[model samples]
Structure formats: C-alpha cells, structure tokens
Target: MDKQEQALGLLQAAVESMGGQVRPGQQEMVKHVVEALDEERHLLVQAGTGTGKSMGYLIPALAYAQTSPKPVIVSTATLALQSQIVGRDVPRLLESLKGKLSRPMDVSLLKGRSNYLCQYKLGGGYPDEDEGALFSMDEKPPASGTVYSPLANEVMKLREWAEHTETGDRDELVPGVSDKAWRQVSVSAMECLGSQKCPMADECFSEMARARASEADVVITNHALLAVSAFEGLNVLPDFDVAIIDEAHELQDRVTSSVAGALSARMVLTAAGGAKRHCAVNVDELTKAAHRLEKSLTGIPTGLMDKGLPEEMGIALNDIVEQSRLVLALTKPEANAPADGGRQTARSQLQAIMDDAIRMLETEERREVLYTTRPREFVDGRGYVESDPGTPATLNVAPLSVAGKLREGLFDGRTVVLTSATLAIGAQFDSVAGSLGLMGAGAPSWEGVDVGSPFDYPKQGILYVAKHLPKPGRQLSAETLDEIEELITASGGGALVLFTSKRSAEEAAEILRPRLDAEILCQGEGSMKSLVEQFAADRDSCLFGTMTLWQGVDVPGDSCRLVIIDKIPFPRPDDPISKARTEDIARHGGNGFMQVSATHAAIRLAQGAGRLIRSVNDKGVVAVLDSRMATARYGTFLKGSLPPMWPTVDKKTILGVLKRLKP
Candidate 1:
C-alpha cells in the first residue's frame, strides 16, 4: 500500500484496538490534516463535539513528527486538556503507533513559570517582598502589616515538595493547593524573574519544561501561555512543524484577553512601593499618581451603570495615564542598581497598564452599547461617582489583527493546525479565520475540515425556546424568571441556568431558590471547581452562573439534565473595547453587531449546548429563554449553529423528556 493507504489502515486498526469505531468522515479529516502539514499549509479543522478529534489530529501530527525535522506543537485551551494530551492521550497513541511510524516520538507539557513551584520561595528567598508572605506561613494567618512576611514558612514547604514531586505540575499536588497558596509558588508573567537572573535558574521547573519541549515530538500548553509566547515573542514552544489548536473556538477571546492589560490604583501603588526600594526619587510622585487616578476615576460610578463609556471618561483616563508615566519614569532606578530587578518589573507593569490606557484614549470609538453591572458604587453623592462598593471599573479590548503578530512574532513560518469543536459559525470558516488574521496576505494555504460529533444531537436532545415570552428587555424580564422557575421545577434541579450578566444570574437564582427543591449553587459563592463539584456530587443540584460558566463548565450524564440560557450573549453597551471594535468593524463597512456580537454569542451558546450531552448516551434539554430565537431575523442563524437537535417550542414536550431521564 502507498503512504496514504498505510496510514489510513493504521488509524483504522488503532481505533478498533481501542474499542472505537472509525467513520469515513473522521478518516478523511485525519488524512487532510496530515496532507496539509506535508504541503506546509495552515489547516482550520472544525471537528464537531464527538469526532474523536484528539486522535484524529494526533495520529497525523505524530506521523509527520517522526519523519519531519521539526517537532509539532499541540496547543489547547485548558490545562485539563494539556494534561490529557501530554499525560494520557499521546502516551497511549505512542504505544499504538510504535514500530509503525518512522521512529518513537517524545511528548511533553510546557507551562509558564507560575505553573511551577518557585525555588526561592521554598528556600525562603525574600520574606519581605509583597508575595513573600505566602511562603511565610503554613496556614491562613492574620493579615500582617507587611505583605510578604507572614507566609514565608508555607512557601518553603511548597517549594521543597515541588522539587521532590515527579510531575512538578501544580495539578498533581494532592488536595490541590488554594489559589492563594499557589500564588506564592507560581509566578505571573509580569512578576517572573527571567531564567538568567532568577536565583534558582539551574533547577528551574520552567527551564526543565522547556528542555523537554525542545526534545519532544509534540508539546502541549494552555491558551494563556500560547498567547503569551506569541505576545511576548518568546521561543518557549518546541520547534513545531505545525500546531493543532484544540478548542479553536476560544482562540479569539483567549488571545484578546491575553493581549489586553488592566490597571488598578492598588496595583500602581504596589509597583510604586516596590520601586521605592531601589530609586532615590521621591515616593511622593507614586502617591500622587494613585490619588490623581482615584480623583479622575471618582467621576464615574462603579458597578453596572447604564451609561456608556463616555469620551470625557476616556479623556480622564488619559490624564491618569499621563500622571502614571510621570511617576514611573521618576521612580525608575539606575540601570546598574542592585534593586534594578524590582524596578524593571515595576516599569514593565506600568508600561502594560499604560498601553491599555492609551488604547482607550486614542481610539475614536463611540459607546453605543452599555452593560449594566452591580459593581460597588463608590460615590460622594454626585449620582454615580467611580468609588462604589463592589463595583470595579474594567475595560475590554480585542486586537484587530493578530495574524501578522503571530506569523512575524510568534509562528514565523512554523506549521500550525488550528482545531476546535465550534470553530465554524453557521458553516463559515472565514468568520473565525478572519478574526485570527488567518486571512492575512501571503498566509499559508491551509486545509479545513469538520470531524462530526459522536452524539446524535437530533435524537438525544431537544432545543426548546420560550417563543411565547416577551422579547427579553435590558433588565431580567419577569417572564424570563417565571420560565426559569418552571424549568428548574420540571427538571428537578438537574440543570445549569446561564445568564448574560452576573446580576441576572443572581436574580434568577434568588427567584428560583425558594421554589426549587434542590441545592442552588451560584458562581460567586465559591470557586468554579467547588461549585461544579457540589453540583456533580448532588444529582439534583442546579448551577446558576454567567459568561465563563457558559463554556468552561463540564458535567456529563443525568447530573445535568437541562441547560437553560437566559438570553443571547451580546456585547454590553459602554464597554470601551467592544465599542471601539464595533466601530472599527463598521468603518470597514461590515455588520459590527452580526460580526462581533452575534458570532460571539453563537459560539458560546454552542459550547453551552455541547456541555449537556458529553457522551453518546447522554440526553438532555437545551432551553433558550429568549423568544428572539424565533422572532429575530438572526435567530435562525444562531439556532443553526447549535447541535442538530430535535428542536421544539413546546414546554410540555421538554418536561416529558426530563421526566423520562429522571432517576
């Protein structure tokens, strides 16, 4: 047999050996992805939910890796997935493909610094530093006057254990450390001391990971790190011939968030405080900058206000930026100073914050959209001043083009294979491709394929929309609440009710809590894993959340029998970044709402629906509370993006399906 035929035969035998049945479409996808690599073209594969996409891409990539000179990088959206590939998937496949491929392939997990244990903390490097407190204690101690003193001991313990541990991955640490504890051991992108300067450079976990990545045939990493490598222009990933981006649907948002930077008064003050240790400049400038920022921010109200991001506020933000740079420049220490390490860290941070401020100030984007949030309103009675309790002022920005940056700064002629379950929006690959700059001039010619899902959506689930309800208004409608209560009661609390906003989520939870019999789990009540664990432990538990929960959550089987979407997720008005992006789209004569808003919601909704039936036998109901699914002209498009479920508008039919699935 020829190369193609032999490879196909191996895949067929491999799947059967693992007790899986291979379909023709799946085999074709594998072949095409492999073929794309051979030609040095980019590939956008939209493998549906159950297409066994991991193996499909892995097989081809591994085959190419053995004979090809360069290694392959397999990027994923989550650490959970990275682990699955490096720890589970690739190893199993290696054994399966052994002696068949040209040679054995090495696979490794490459994570950013924060994912590893800090040896300095373990050895008690700097107990006086801000985060040093985490290493000072074994337990949550009383808040000390200094930031880093009290937690020193705990940091040492964590460091020592990390050195002895086999995986060195935070995930493998038993009982898993808390975020606070993890913060002490792990370093953020900004806070990370470079390999050359770090005290523990020789035994560094990050370096060890890099070494493995360099030698491996396949390297796996999370979206954040992948974006960081691209953004920072770091050669952290292996010399990959091609990258298969699993969970490609999240690429835009993930890349946008990674590139975006945030600044707060507290962060500035902290950095300024750190700078004081090195420079002879007066500390007064740092304090002044913080006070001025507070004064300017005082003009707006915290929390979800109806007002859009006003041009005046943008200008005020610019003023704050000016003061910020003045302080940073003044406090910046001499290059040869010993404390220059801390000063450099602070300067980079201030610069990142300045970049965001400048982006908002420089853009001529109008704020037509507004997202009303319940951020703590900090005001001195001028009707919504920025200082509100619980309300935080945050800005969102998405890069207009990352393709040039990725190609020139990140990929630089490397082979890349982007994969995701929901990469396609209504059967159009260009929609997602355009967002990532894959449509850039002289971009590689990549193949595209959709490996179908294993689940029969049309047979296993029903898509129910409350067509009778009034169109959802700006606020959570009464009819929407009523439908939620009804669905929860009918489904016996084995449900996940996702809202467009946190306020609406809490409101719905409050309304349904008294009436529903099962335990109610709200997102803010605890960490995501805690809430998910609680929901999974109790069959009748219901989870109510917004945004992240729409896609990040996963619960298979009857524990989650129904998925309820409060409304379509559209961009909030007054959001600085989204507003600017929308205008940018319109200026180019494109439908901003359809391109940015609708497409975002459609992908999220698809992800939410995909959460319901994780396996072939899993059955459930997907209920969209918004009547817009049937009334709006764009409704059909959104509905079509979801799984080909047996859709219905009948409330009774949905309840019947739930009853049959109930224990």
Candidate 2:
C-alpha cells in the first residue's frame, strides 16, 4: 500500500482499539496533513473537539517521519495537552503500529531548561550569597521548635526524589512543589552554564533530554520552546523538516511572549546583590540607580508608552547601564573560574537588562510597543505585603506583531500543519491566517479546511442570549445575576460561569453563593486542577472563574451541562498591546476594530461557549448574559464563530432546555 493508505489503516486501527469509531472529519484531516507534508506546503486545519485531532495528525506525521531523513516535531500550547499527547496518544498509537513501521519510531518529550533540576544548584552550589536570601531556610517556630516550614519540607522532598527520578522533570514530582520552591533548584536558559562547563555535565537532565530528542524519530515540545528555537536561534530541539502545531490559535501570543524583553527594578536589585557577593562592585550606587529608575517609572501612568521615554527616565536608564557595565567589567567569568556560575548568571541578567533598557530608550521601531505596568501584588495587595511604599514597575518592550518573524524563521524551509478547534473566526480562516503571517502578499500559498466537530451540536446544545436584559456595562447587573441564578437552578448546578474579569467573577460568586442551594467554587480558592476535580466529583456544583477557565478548561459530560458567559470577552480599553495593534491595523488601511479587537473577542467567545458540549452524548445550554450578542450589529459575526448550536433569546426556553438536560 502507499503511505496514505497505510496511514489511514493505522488511524482506523488506533481509533477502534480505543473503542472510538473512525470519524470522517478525522480521515479528511489525516489526508490533508499527508498532502501538506508531501508537497512541503503549509496547511491550516480547523478540527473541532472530539475529532480525535491528535491521531489525525500523528498518524500521517509518523508515516512521513519513518521515511524522512529528519525527525518530526509536534508542538502543543499547554503542558496538559503535551502530557495527553506524550503520555497517552503517542503511546497508544505506537503500540497499535508496533511492527508496521518501516523503521523504529522513537519519541521524546522535551521542555524548557527551567523545568529540569540544575545539578549544580542541587549540590548546594548557589550562584551567590543573595541567592540564599531569596530562598531562605530560616523559620520562626512555635514553642515546640519543630522547625516547620513549607519551603524547607519541599526542598527536602525534592532532594530525596532527585536521586531516584529518571528525567528529573518537575511534573513527575508528587504533590507538586510551588513555583517559589522550584526556583531554588532550577536554572533558566540564561542562567545555565553550558553542560561542558558545568561540574554536573555528565548527568545534566536538560542536556540528556536534548540528546534523546536528537536521536528520536518524533519530538514533542511546546510552542514557547518552538519559538525559542525558531526566533532566538537556540538549539533547544532537534532539527526537523516537518512540524504539527496543536492548539495553533495560541501560537502568535506565545511567540510574542517568547521574543519580548523586559526590565524591572527587582531584576536590577537582584543582579546588584549577586555582584556584591562576588565582585568588588559599588552595590550601593547600583541600588540607588535602580531605585531612581523605579521612582521615575512610578510617576508614569501604567500603560503603553506611546511617546518616547521621558527625559528623567532616560537619564536613570543611562545611569543603570553605566553601573551594569562597571560591574560586568570587574566580574569577568574567566577571572572567577570554578565558582563563576553565579557571576555568569548575574552578568547575563544585567547585560540583558541593560540591552532592553537601551532598546526601549533608543529604538524608534514602530513595530514594537513599550509599556510599564506594576506587578499584580502591588496592584491588588493579594499575595504579599509590600515593605516599600514605592513598588517598582516593570517596563516591557515587545514586538507589535510576530507575523514577520514567524514567516521568515518558521515557515521558510519547512512544512507546517497548524490545527486548532478555534482557528477560524466567523466561518473563515482569513483573520487567523493574516495574524499568523500566512496571508500577506507574496507569502507561500496554503490551504484551509474545516473538518468540523463530531458532536451533533444543534441537537445536543442550545445557545441562549438574554436579549431582554439591559446591555452589560462594566459589571454584571442585578438582572443578569437573577438570570444566572434562574439558569443554574434549572440546570441543577452543573454549571461553569466564565467572566471577563476577576472582579466580575468574585462579585457574581458572592451574590450567587448565598442565594443558590448548590455548592459554588471560585477560581482563586484553590489550584485549577483541584477545583476542577471538586467540581467534577459533585453533581450539584458550579464553578466561577475568569480568563484561564475560559479556554483551558475541558470537563465533559453532565458535570458541565451549563456554560454561562457574563459578557462578550473583549479587549479592555486600556490594554496596551491590543490598543497598539488596533491602531497599526487602521494605519495599514484595515478595520482595526474588527480585525484586531472583534476577532479576539470572537475566538474567546467561541472558546467560552465550547465548554458546554464536550462529548457526543453530552447535552447542555450556553447562555450569554450580554445583550450585545443579539442586539448589536456584530452579533451575527460573533455568533457565526461558534458551533451550530440551537439559538434562542427567550429565557423561558433556555430554562426549559436546562431542566430537561439535568439528570
């Protein structure tokens, strides 16, 4: 048989092995992926949930990789999806194709450097004395003097597991450690000394993973690392001729974040602290310089820096650069030799800070945006109490668009297959394609296909728009709350309410929790996994959360029979990046509002509404509390982006459907 037929056979066998029928959409997606790889063309496929997209792409990718000279890279958007692909889907497919391949099909899962333990750090070899201050072991115990501290306990557990763990991946640790504790044992790519230069080179986890990926037939990675490899020119993964980007809708955002640069007062202070421990540097002067910069930033409003850097801020940044240069000159790595890891890390960080500061101050690139914003702690006082009244803000310099970078670095000489459930907005892939640099003049030609969802959306789900309610303003109204209460009551409380902001979610939860008979869980009460578990365990429970819950959640069946969106998820008026992108589009003779803001809202709205029906047997109602969905001119455009659910505006009809769907 030809490669295409063999791949189809493998897909069919794998699906049947898992007790799933071979879907027509899955078959079409497989065929398109094979054609894309064969012709070395870029392809975008919109395969909705339950199309078994993983296998649809994987089968063709594996078949091609078996005969190709290079390995295939599969990049996903989330660690959860990565785990699902590497831990479940890949293994199941490989088992089904155990003896049918032309060559050995080896697979490896690779993550960023920080996800693995740094042996040098684990051996009590800190970069500097201030490193210990950042991760202190000291504790103020009770009268018993038991020395109880969560950080200390977690460190000990990590140490014990380090000896026995094979991969040393953070995800493998049971009762996972906090981000604060993990920082003590891990090193960022910038912080890591090369494997050849490190004392633990022979046993480096990150290097070992890279070596495995180099030899494997398939390498599973994330979009962030893919961006690092393509844009930063980092050799983080093996060379590949073909790539399948799962959750491709998040690619632009991930790429933008990966390439962005930031400068903050805390980073300067930390670097100064480290330099003082090892080099004969003027720590006090550097500290004062950082403080001056911080004070200057505090004066500027927290938003996009449309104008050039202020005079005072420019002077402060120059002072910081001068100080950083003096420290770097004194703390040369060659002079510090064996114990230079800390000095090198500090030097790299300082150099990066100086470079970004200079770029923001000097560069006149219209394609980049410069902005300053205070951290969440200072904004809301949620996590820690601030010691200084002047909490330092962070200055970010990021690309206004990653389309050009992606086109040049990623799709130049490789075949790419971008697939997602939300790739298309309003029944066309043009908006998303343009965002990904795929639709520009003289760009390589590509094909777009929507294989569609396996679920019977029209019969299994209802889209309820509360057109009678007053238009949603900044907050959820009393009428909207009553509508939510009525729907949750009718559905018997297996509901997931997605809000546009945390304030809205918290406020709604407060009012609904006291009035409703069912148990209500808020986002911040615990980790998302634990919250989802609790929500799934109880049939009469409701979950209320903001953005992350809008897209990342995936609970199927009766546990999520009702999905309610408080309002259309739109870009906030003050969002710096969104504002900049909108204006840029308008300058280029495009409808900035529709091309940038409305498309963003439509994708998120579809994601939020998609939470209702996850399986073919599942039935539910997706209620949008915003009257704009039915009353506004863009309502049809927004509604068209979603699945073909039965639409309605009568509240009574939705309540009746919810009651019928309840177990």
Candidate 3:
C-alpha cells in the first residue's frame, strides 16, 4: 500500500489501541484530511468532539513532515491544547511512530516572550529598582522553613533553574504560576530587547525557544502569536511551510485582536512619565495628549458604536493623535545610551498604535465605526475604557470581506489548514468562509469534510432544553431558576452551570448554593486554573461562570458529568461590534439575526456542549436551559450548532441518565 493508505492503517491501529471506536464517517474524514493535505490545498475539517482528531491530523502532519524537510506548525487556541500536543501527544506519538517514518522527527513549542521568565527580571534589572516594593515576594517571608520563602525567593529559584531549562518555558515549571505572577518575571514582545542587545543574550528563554523551533521538524504555538507573525509581521515564529490551526473557528477573532491595539489614558500617562524618567520627551505635550485622548475616548459609547463615526469626536482624537506623534517624534534615540533602548521601543509602540488609529479613522467602509467610554469611573479623575467584561471592548470592522487582504498578507505566501470541531456553524460554510474573505474566485479553492466523533452522541449525551421558560432578552425568569435547581440536583454536583452574564452566574450561584450540597465555585473566585483544579480535585464541585468558561475550559472524565447552559448564549443586544456586524449583514439583505447573533450563539452553544465529552471514556448531559433552543424556529439553527447530542425534553430521563454517571 502507498504511504497514505499505510498512514490511515497506523491511525486506525492507534485509535483501536487507545480503545477508541472510530465511526465510519470519522474514518472517511481521516482519509479525506490526509488527501487534502497531500494535495497542498486548503481544507476546513469539522471534527466534532470525541473524534480522534488530534491523532487524525497529527499522523498526516507528521508523515508529511517526515519525508519533507519543511516544518509544520500546529496552532491551537488555548495553552491547554498546546501543552497537550507538546508534552503529551508529540512524545507519545514519537515513541509509537518509531521506525515507521523515513527519518527522525523533532517537535518544539513556541510562545510569545511573555510566556518565558526574563532572566533580567529574575536577576534584578527591572525598570523599577525598588524591587522589594514592586514585587511583594521580597517584602514577605515564605511560610517558614519552606524552600520558597519570599515570592522573590520563588522567582530566584526559578531563575536559577532556568540555567538548566532546555525548553525555557514557564509551563514546564513544577508548579504553574498565575498570569499576574508570570508578568512579574517575563517581558512582553514590545518590552523585550533583541538577543544582541539583551544582557542575557546567551541564556534568553525566548531565544532558546526560537533556536529550538528552528531545529525542530514540528512546532506548536497559539493563534495569537501566529496571527501576530502573519498579520503584524513580527517574525516571532520560525519559518514553516504549512500551519494547522486546530481551533480554526476562533482564528478571525484572534487575528483581529492581535492587529487591534488599545491604549488607556492611564497606560499612556504611565508610559510617558516612565519614559521621561529615563528618556527625554515633551512631557507637557505628552500629558496634554493623554488628557485629550482620555476625554475624546470618554465620549464614545461602550459595546457596539455602530452610530456613524462622530465628526466632533473624530476631530478631537485627530488633535490628540497629532500631539502624540509629535511627542514620539521628539524623543529621538541616542546611540548606545541607556535610555536609548527604552526611547526607541516606546517610539515604535506609540507610532504603531497611532498608525492603527489613523487607519481606523481613514477606512471608508460605512459599516466601520468607533466609540469611547470609561470602563470604570473613579472618584478622582481615574477612569478606564468600558469594554464588555465578558468580551474585549473592541472596535470591530469587517472590511466587507477579509479575503483580499488575507490572501495578500497571510495565505498567498504559504499553505494554510483550518480545522475545527465547529467551523461551519449552519451546515453551510458561507457564514465562516465569508467572514474570512474566502468567498471569492478560484483564489485557493476550499473543500470541507466532517470527521464524526467516536462517542454515539445520541446515546452518550442528552440535550435538555427548558421549553416552558420565557425568552432571555429580558431579565431571566423565576422558572429558569427553578429549572436550574432541579437540573443541578439531578446532575448532583458535577456540573458547569454556564451563564450568558456574570450577574446571572452570581445570582445562580447564590440560589444554588443554598439548595445544592456540592461545593460552589464561581468564576470571580479565582483564576481559571485555580477553579479547574478545584473542580477536578472534587467531582462534587459545580462551577458557575460566564462566556469565558464556555470555550477555553476542558474537564474530561467524571469530574464534568453535566454541562448546564443557563441560557442561549446570545450576543448582547447592545454589543457595539455585534450590532454593527448585524447591521452589515442586514444591509446585504441577509437575516442579520441568523448571520450574526444566532451564529455567535450557535458557536458558543457548541462550545458549551463540547465541555461535556473531552475524552473517549467521557460522557455527560448538555442542558441548554433556553426554551428557544427547542420552541423557536431558529432553535433548529442553534441546535445544528451543537454536537449531535441525543435530544430529550423529559426531565426524568435526563436526571436518571446523569445520576447513573459519576458525580
């Protein structure tokens, strides 16, 4: 048999050895995915959860990279998946595929600089020399006699360990740290000095990662870095012939987010003042610009600012932009000066931001709009931009289509493979394909295939919709709460009660806390990792969280036996970006609700359901509490977005099924 056939046989063998039953459709999907990759054409594969998708794609990608010298980059949307690939899958697969491939294969994980601790910061060159005050670790003693005394002591130990760290990744640290703690140790891309200029040149974590990436046959990274390299041209990632975007559905959002930069008045002021401490600048103009920018941004509304671009606001921001430009221009870099490095970096960052603002102001698309609002209003002149707590406060403008620009910038130069469990939200790929500007001509033709899941969704999970409940646009009803209590009791304590709003999550947690015996864990209680760890440690823990919990979280096995969505994950009625995108859809004579709101809800619903079955032995009930999921005409559309779970409105059956599973 040929290499493709042989590869498929190996994949089947691997799946069976892992005790995973492959469906006929899933088998076909594996065949087609390999075929598409071999052809060097783009393929959007939707492999629902339970499909051995990681293996299906990995086998082909490794096979292709084995014979060819060019490396393949696997991009995931979450750090969890990235770790799984690098730490677990790659190593295990390498052992399994030994002597099978033509040559030895190497794998590496690449991340943004911030993911790695800066040896300089660990050593004490932080811009703030008052390290003990800035970093609390030095201020306090480690809980007696423990190796980790002050927090700084922990950082020091980590730095010492860095000398022997081959991967130079913080994820490999024995005890993972919080993002806040990580920030104290690591430096962002904009903040990092290149190898030649950096004092820690030979031992830089970022440089080590880069060198490893260059030498490896396969590289793993997240969408943000890939998007940054592709769109912003940062040259952060090593050269690769092809990239497989695992959670392809989230790519556009990731790309848009990377290209879009935001600066708060406080951030600007802090940066300017910080720069003045070292580098020379027109401090007065910088201060004035910060105040003016703050005032101008304050006038813009939060959520979606679809209202046509305001001329007065535009004029006001223009003046501030000009002032910023001048201040940045005057702060010229001096050769080899200590302050020169800081000055040049600050200049580039500010200019890049100003350029983005200029482009936003200049874009002719009528649908494109801008807004300004304070996130928080302090009693004393301190305020921040009011972005959605659940979503980034963003100025989203789909340039009618992104295809032309995407083709010109990211696609034409290389081979791209977009794979996800739910890329095509409505059976038709147009909604997704259109968003990416992939709807046009023979310009890189596209083919789509569905890789069926291993679990018999019809038997493994039940879709419970509270059909008697009212619509969710208004305040959630009392009946919704009642149903939630019943479901929680039915599922016992092993459940993720998903909510569309933090308020709902809080309210539910309050009501359910009094009613259920399980340990109640809420989102605001701690970091996501902390919450996940708590939930895993005790199967009787119920987590109530908002939008973020819907997608990024993954709790396999008995720990997560019931996934409860409190409502249809709808786009907020007042969301500025969604509102504008909806309008744009309507302007094209399409159903805006279906195109925007419903599509968004559909993706989230699928994501929420996906939290249920994360492994071969996993099983659970996905209870979407919104009645619209069953009664409304659009309910079918939303249901289509979910995994093909067995449908059941019968509460008794669902409760029985959930009870039979582990709590």
Candidate 4:
C-alpha cells in the first residue's frame, strides 16, 4: 500500500490495540495534515477535545519524516503539551509503528537553554547577589538579607542529581524544584556562553539536545523556542521542512512574550553585583545609574509610552547603557583570572544583562511598543510599585504585532498546520487567521477545516446563562454569589469556577466556603498542579481560580460537573499593550472592540466552558453568571464560540439538571 494508506492502517491498528476506534475528527485531521505536507501548503485545523489530535498529527508527520530529508518540527504552546507529545505520544507512536514504518523515526524534544541545568552555572559560584545565595556558604551573605533553608536543601539535592542524571533536564527532578531554586542552577539563552567558549561544552545539556534535534527525523519544541528561532532569526533550532503548531490559539501570546524585553532596577543591581565580584569593577557607578533610572521612572505614571518618554527618563536609560558598557569593557578577564566556571559564568551573566539593557534602550523600532508598569506577584496578584520603598517600575518593550513576522518567517516556503480546539471564534477562523498574520494580501493561500468533536455536546452538557441576574458590575455581586452557592449546593460540589481576576476569585471563594457543604480550593492556596490533583482526587470539591484555570485545567469524570464563569473575560482597561493594539486596529479601519476585545473574551469563554464534558461519558453544566451573555447584542457572537450544548436561562431548569447529575 502507499504511504498514506499504510499510515492510516497503522493508526487504525494502534487505536484498536488501545481498545478504541479511530475517531472521525482524528481521521479528518490526519488526512488534512498529510495533504498539507504533500503540497507544501498551509492548513488550519481546529480539532476539538477528545479528537486525539496529538496522534492525528504525529502519525502523518512521522510517516512523512520517515522518507523526507528534513525533519518535521512540532511546536506546542505549553510545556505540558510538549512533555505530553514527547514523553507519551511520540513513544507510543514509535512502539506502534516499529515494523510498519518505511524507515526509522527518531524524535527529539528541544527546550530553551533555561529548561536544562547549566553545569557551568552549577559548578561555578552564582553571581554575588544572584538567586544562588543558598549555595554559597563560603562567601559573604547575600545582600537581600533573607535566608531560605528549604532552598539550601533543594540546591544540594539538585547537585547530587546533577552528578548522576544523564539528561540534566530540570523536569526530570523528582518533585520538581521551585522556580526560585531552579534559577540558582540554570542559565537562560542570553546568559549562556557560546558552547565553543565553555569548558563544559561537551557535556552541555542544551547543546546536546540541539545536536540530537539536528539529526532526528522529528523535533518537538515549544512556541517560545520556535518564536526565537523564526522571529528573532536565532539558529537554535534545526531547519525543518514543515511545522505543526499545536495549541495554535496561544501562539500569538506566546510569541509576544518571547520577543518582549524588560529593564528593572532589581536587574541592574544584580548585574552590577556580578560585575563587582568577577570584574572587580566598582559597583557604585552602576548603582548610581540604576538609582537615576529608578527615580526617573517613579515620577512617570504607569502606562504605555506611545507618545514619548520623559527627557530625563531617556537620559537615565542612556546613562545606564553607557555605564554597563564601560563596566563590561573595564572588567575584561585578567591574564591570571581564576579558570573556575564561577568566574566565567559570572562574566557571561554580566555581559548578557548589559546586552539586554542596550536592547531595552532601542526605541526607534516603530513596530514595537514601550510601557512602564508595576510587576505583580504571580501567586497573589499583588502589585509592587515604586512607592513601596525599594520596588522599582519596569520598562517593557514588545512587538505590537507578530503577524507580519510570523507570516514572513514561519509560513513562507514551509508546510504549516495550525491546530487548536479554540481556533474558531464566533464560528469562524478569520479572526484567528488574521491575528496570526495569515490573512493579508500576498499572504500564502491557506485553508481551514474544523473537524467537529466526537462527543455529543448537546447530549452531554448544558449551557446555562443567568438571564434573570443583574448586569455584572466591577465585582461579583451578592446575588451572583448566592446563585453560585446554590449551583454548587445543587451539584454537591464538583464545580470549577473561573474568574477574570484574583480578587474576584478570592471573594467568591470566601463567600462560598462558609455556605457550601463541600471543600472550596482557591488558586493561591497551592501550586496549580497540586490544587488540580487535590481537586481531582476529591470528587466533591470545587476549584476557584483566575485565568490559568480557564485554559490549563483538565479534570474529567465526575470530579468536574459544573463550570461557572463569573463574568466575560475582557482585557483590563488599563492593560497598555491591549489598549494600544486596539487603538492601532481602529486606526487601520478595523472594529477594535470586536477584533481585539470580543474575540479574546470569546476564546476564553469557550475554554472556560470546555472544562465541562471533557470525555464522552462526562456530563456537566456550564453556567455563565454574566447576564450580558443573554442581554447584550454581542451575546450571540460569544455564545456561537462555545460548544453546541443544550442551552437554558431558567434557573430552575439548571438547578434540577445539576441535582440529577450529583453523586
């Protein structure tokens, strides 16, 4: 049989072996992927959940890679998906296709340098004020004056693991290390000394991974690395014949973050401390420059710097750039400098920070937007402002749009397949395609195919909009909280409530905790993984969280039967980047509200609603508490983005359904 037929046969056999049948959506996806690869054309496929999209794309890509000269690259938006593809799907496919494939298929998963342990950074001491204080007992105490006993223990464990582990991947660590602890041993791409210049070059984990990718038949990577490779013109990833981007809906956000740069007072102090220790450069000069920048930033209001930055702030940034360059030049390695990895690593880090500072000062790029903002604590969502004593405002820079860059750099001359469950906003792919820079004139022709879900949405789920409720104000109203409590009570928990902000989540959790009979878990109480695990294990429990839970959560079975969204997930009015982008769209004669705000909310709503009915046997209720969903003109557009679940606005109807579904 031909390769396509053989590939399909293998897929069928593999699914049967797993006690399942080939889903029609999966078959359709595979067919489209194969055709796109054969013709070297771009294709957009929206394969819904339970469609086995991973296997769908992998089979075709692997079959093609078996005989193709160039490797096939699969880029995912999340590390979870990347690990799923590499650790689970690829291995399963390889085992299933052992004797059926035309040739051997070698797969390699490549991540950014920061994801791997940097032996150079680990063996070498950390920069004076870096996150490695817990590892440096011989030196003076860290300037931060804080000592973490847990961090010290974690570092020792990592050192032992480093000696015995072959891959040196951070993910391989048992009971994964905290981000703060990981930062002590890992170095980002910017901080890495070129492999050729490093003494541990031969054993570098990132370099070895890249080498394997270069020779492998299939390479798996994330959207951030792909963005770096394609947009920034980086040669980190190997050249490929085609790319399959999973979770394609997240591509734009991931790419924006990948290309973004920031400058902060804390960063300057850390870099200066490193230079002071390694280069023996006086830190006072650099410290003074940082202080000037901090002072200038403090005087300015936090928002987009679209019009122009203050003259004093501009002068301060220039001074910082100059001071950093002088420090780097003056601190050149002495002939008798210690040859230990610590000294080299410190110097490299200092250089990287200087490079970043220089790049942050480049304001001539019209396509880039600049802003001054306060940093938020990731766990609690508390903002740190300059008025908070030592806290300093950050200057941010990022591309206004990645579409042009993605179109020219990624889609050109390469067979591209973009697949995601939420790609179609308002029952159309045009918004997604346009956002990805694929719709402009002279752009390569592309086709979209939405292989509908296998599960019967209307039979398995209920979409309940609270039409009788008042319009949602700035916060969750008392009446809305009462409704949520009643729904949870009726369902006997097993609910996942998604909020647009942390405060709202906390408020709802507080009000519900006292009233509900089941356990209520909030986001800041623990890590997302642990919370999700706890929620899954406790079938009667409910989880309340903000944006992260909206998309990243997956809890099938009776553990999640009720999904509640407190409001439409609109972009905050003060979000500088979103506001600027909306204004820019309006200037170009596009409906900014519909294109930017509504489309964003629609995608998020779909994701929130998706928390219910994860499997064919799974049945649940998705209650959107926002009355605007039923009263507003745009409600129809938003509802169109969700699954075709049986709809209802009657409270009694939803309450009865929830009671019947309760365990």
Encode model 4's per-residue lDDT on 1-663: one tens digit a residue: 765676688789778766787799998888888888888889999988899999999999888887888899999998888988899888877887777776777999999999999887777634522444554554443457675688786777778789898888888888888888888888877667667666788988999999999999999999999898878788978998699999998999899898888887777877787777766778797788888888877756677887866787777777777787787678666665544454555566666556656665665554778888775544434322224334567888888888999988898878899999999975689998998888989888998999989999999999999998999887679989999999999999999999998888887888778888899999999989999999999999999999999998889999999999999998887778788889899999998988888988999899889888889899999999999999999999999999999999999999999999999
lDDT of 1 by residue, 1-663 (tens): 655676687798678767778766578778878777777778888877667788888888777777766677778887877887878887777777667776667877888777887665445543334543643344344466644533454555565677578656787776576676677566565655567566677876777888878887777787787787787766767655577788888776777667765555656666566556544445565566565555445445533323445665555556657866886768655544442345555666666666666765543352222222224443432323333444334443345545566666545677678887888877788878777766758665656677777788888888999999998886788888888887887778889889887777777777778877888999998988889988888889999998888877778878988999988877766554455566668998999888878887888889888878887788889999988998899998898789899888988887777777777
- Which runs in model 1 stand beyond 4 Å of their true positions? 1-3, 127-157, 280-291, 300-398, 401-404, 407-412, 440-444, 524-527, 530-541
Residue 280: error of model 1 in Å? 4.3
Q: Candidate 2 vs candidate 3: which has greater lDDT?
A: 2
Q: What is the lDDT of residue 545 in candidate 3?
A: 91
lDDT of 1: 0.72
Answer with 1 or 4, whichever has the higher TM-score.
Answer: 4
Cα-based RMSD of the predictions, in order? 5.2, 3.1, 4.6, 3.8
Candidate topping TM-score? 2
Better of 3 and 4 by TM-score: 4
Residue range 1-663, candidate 3, lDDT tens digits:
876797787676666656666566566666776777777777788888766577777887887777766678899987878998888887877776667777888888898888887777666555532335235445344576655435545555565666687766887887765555566677777667667567777877788888888888889999888877766667888777787889888877676666554555665666567567656655676667666656655535565455544665465446557766776767755556452344545665666546655655665642244443335432322222244443223333334334455666666756777788888766777777766656767466778767666667777777888776777655557888888777777767888888888777876787678887888999988988899889978887889898889886778878889888888878777765567667777887989888778888888788888999887677788887777888899999888888777888888887788778754
The lDDT leader among the candidates is: 2
Clash count, predicted structure 2: 0
Q: Which ten residues in a row have the lowest lDDT in candidate 1?
A: 366-375
TM-score of each: 0.84, 0.94, 0.87, 0.93
Score each candidate by Cα lDDT: 0.72, 0.84, 0.72, 0.84
